[model samples]
Target: MNIFKKNNNLFYLIYFFLYLTLITGFIFDENPAGGGKKDYLLLQVHLIETGFTNGVMHYLFDFFPNGTLQHSPIYYIIIYYLKSIFSPDIIRLIIIHIFLIIPFYFYKSLKLINIGNKYICILIPIIFFISPNFRSVALWSGREILSLLFLIISIFNFIKFQKNKNTKNIYLSFFFLILGSYISPEIGIISIVYFYKLIRLINLRFFFKLFFFNLILSLPFLYYIIFFYSDNEFNNPLLVNLYKNLSSFFSSICIVTIPFIIFKDIKKYFLFILENKKLIIFILFISFFILNSPYNYEFGGGVIYRLLNLYGFEKIIFIFGFLGFLNLIFLIKEKLYYNLFVIIIFILHTSLNLHFFQKYIDLTYLFYFIFLFDSKKINDYFNNSILVKLFLTYNLIYYIANISYRIY
Candidate 1:
């Protein structure tokens, strides 16, 4: 299993090269994605005319459209406070600060997966260069970027809790996650895994403790929503739609090879089952859960029939789809964070492509950090070298595409 044996040096060289490419792309990139130069100038003008608080409030509440209200007000206040106290030219400094936060995100992602390898940090800078959303984070301007920072902080604290098992870290994680949820819907993306884990681990005492913890911490948001928030559902400003939850499950079918495995290796797999007798029960258990899902037919129908109209090959799609679903269940059970993060990025790319969002793809780059943590679990296709190569190549193409899009 010497995965790095022959390619260690190449990996190291490419890793550093990727880091430089990512940084230079950001440093020289004037893509006007985030609060662009025009917006920055306008904010400064508004400040001079109306005074600081009014100007900031105008930008925060009155500036954006109906959909923009979903963004967490906490993010607006922080950005306003920083922009007001500092030079009017706050964009460059903000970009620099975001870049500096890269290391923290890198280290925290690895810790989340219990990966102690410090060298994995080398892969952090452009870790999410694969997802277009990440590229925009470097440019700065979107309040979603602030939400991303909160997301990372929450993830880091959760990982810290994983290692230390501290209840305090749990509270800290929830606190930041709450703050992030206000900033964007991205923070709530974590609830899928977070609540599942809590439900799995809950005991009578832990339940009460968590109940009190959530109640006390949720007061600020609850109070704010009731008193301060004027827009309905705060206009869901950050575009965190609950529908994105299904985005990952549906997108998992993108691995076409996994579905094909059913027909290709179906006969031999039975022999494999006999040899690994102990695993059959586990496999059956996962399969049971997969078939039991509410959207069982739709999940497979998309893959075999391509989601347009499910006419041909219904049974073939179902069997293969079931196998793919099983693998997803296995990943969820064993590699929770790794699988969940990939789904988050997949949904981010697939679900958030609004008409006005020119740079959401670039800004949503937080995906890379999580995707890289446990590289071994890249996909179920890793057993085949060609599929593995394809998976890697696919991700690299995304990275290159994002860099090209941002730089150009």
Candidate 2:
């Protein structure tokens, strides 16, 4: 009882309670309609109940011809085997543990970057954990969190490779990255960043050898796409999908960077905006005319789209999207090439998707902000306790609102 009086103990107590609330929410969720949790569970159950046979193999690899299998089969295959060996409850517990341990990985990555202040390093991951999407995905037993876990590990190893110039660390990074891509193909886009880094570090002969080696590993996925995949799964035309994804990408970036923009020196940001007024105006014009409002879609635009739709100010999405574009330009101007390449690759990958969800990019961008952005001004700003408090409060509100609105 006396230990609870200590500040660190109190903080841990609150964190535990918050995590407990998320678990409780998951346990009692009632498997809400349209959130996809029910489908995920049913798929797992189906996998567990069925024997591995020719039909099952075809169903998993061939995208079911009727467009039933929506995602890559690697994740389901692993889950199927795991469920065969253990109960669904055990799998859920494992997932929860995976989610719980992510912050420690974040702490290590931050430390690798020489963040120096232990408290701020700890606070950053806590802020990340408080994210509504992060919590919802974790609670829903979504595969995104698992894929993100692998991706974070990959990033950590990549950072280690950079710090120590260890060839083995780079190999480990690509290995984990490939594992992550197997779980969520979108994560494969990050390999572009890794490849870019390698180009500068390794000789051409070794670089090609490494590239082909990873390519060979990825051949199974490619074979599935070329021989077994169905085109009927995509309802939208390729051009329309690209347009919608690009708009959502910019708007989602705006939403993700709101805390950074708000907490940083406002005067400097305003001056930068002023200096780029013409470019901003051009972007807004293009956004207004070319970027269709995400609210126009019935599903999966992103948080900004939903909020704008809820308030009947859907047209203003263009402005927010433009602001996000400006933010990206500023970050690019900072000469963060690795970060820039990652964002570009992510956009290209998502451009192939028919819909864009905030969940897809929210945590990914947050990870980038925390570890890869590498801006001294932003780093200094993030170290402030006030920013952490504000970020926490914002996410708490978002979590409550997300629950109330069933915005999963």
Candidate 3:
């Protein structure tokens, strides 16, 4: 009875931590404003005004077959409807982005895995929050995070359908995926993986029927692309830009791992790397030195292309990093090794992508809390040997110090 009660309490604590973290994140976003990448802020306001006054909201938000807008009309349309009712401030938009949508999807993902126990459940978002290069995604009131939230929610609902057997959740999941795809095509690709997972679980007849149905449902958005954006600014030149971006995405992951190259003694440092095949894949995916070469032209040109590519690579790093860390925790008997690897991965991943570093820094408190109560053998080692603690502490501090070098 005591064990069961303890388990229940842990579950409650996990949920409570999620709520607290999101509230803190929202509170921190008090002024929420950006100018360079978020010029869409003014564009959204213009669309709302055009809709209210000229009654041609669609045209104003449309592609215009020229170098007018880089994004799709769906996001603007949603804002237009929202502005129809309440005053649309950037803070409110940001609160909605970070607090409502992002955290909810994050909680749902953790809950789906059935690890809602306080210690394990909180690790999901806390890890992501402190991950490097995550600042831009967490704070920015843009289509990317919103679209990602929708995509993840769609996956959650689809997973929920397996147990509830509710047609509604599946339908809603499909709706969000279609909507998210219309907002961000990269999200569309990620959504396909969820759909595939769903198909693998359900019976065949239902799978094909719903699959083709959603595919058809999303086809209309292509009409806007075909008719409106065919001759737009994003043509062959944009295609070349995207190609260059693909190269940088590959290069960033490879180049960033170069620092560890000189540290050949990491074999003694990361037990997680030794035991997990998943960790091996992750290391390969994000280690920049693994992919970069002297003739790497992909790293030097096409800034916008590199920016887009970085989004996909960042997602890969986050998912794999989390997976790798979890596996390390289970296998490693040393607390120092786990803490050091976590710190190193966090620093290396974020240092190169300072623009999005907020995502990783937000979880610092959670990690510190975990480290305080760690049960690994390395904890005893640290307590018994002051020199070991000093050495590890110095390395961790150096990890943070080098992050400044990556900041351009």
How many clashing residue pairs appear in each of the predictions shown?
19, 0, 19
Worst 10 residues of 2 by lDDT: 1-10
| Candidate 2 lDDT over residue span 198-226, tens digit each | 78888999888778878988888877766
lDDT to native, each model? 0.49, 0.69, 0.46
Deviation of model 1 at 337, angstroms: 16
As for model 3, its CA RMSD to the true structure in angstroms is 10.8
- Per residue, candidate 1 scores C-alpha lDDT tens digits across 1-408 of 343344456545665675565566556754423334344344334433443345655644454423333445565466566665775345545654565565557545654664433234334443444334454454445455566677677777776766677888778877787777776644455555665556655576875776677667668666765555544533333353323223233333424234323433456555655775677567546544443222332322222233322554332333443454444443343566656666555455434322123233234333432332244433333334444344445556755654455467
TM-score of 3: 0.55
Better of 2 and 3 by lDDT: 2
Superposed Cα RMSD, model 1 = 9.2
- Candidate 2 ranges with C-alpha deviation above 4 Å: 1-18, 30-55, 62-65, 116-118, 121-125, 233-239, 293-296, 310-312, 336-340
Poorly placed runs, candidate 1 (over 4 Å): 1-23, 30-69, 87-90, 116-123, 199-203, 226-392, 402-408
What TM-score does candidate 2 reach? 0.86
User: For model 1, where is the 10-residue window of minimal lDDT?
Assistant: 353-362
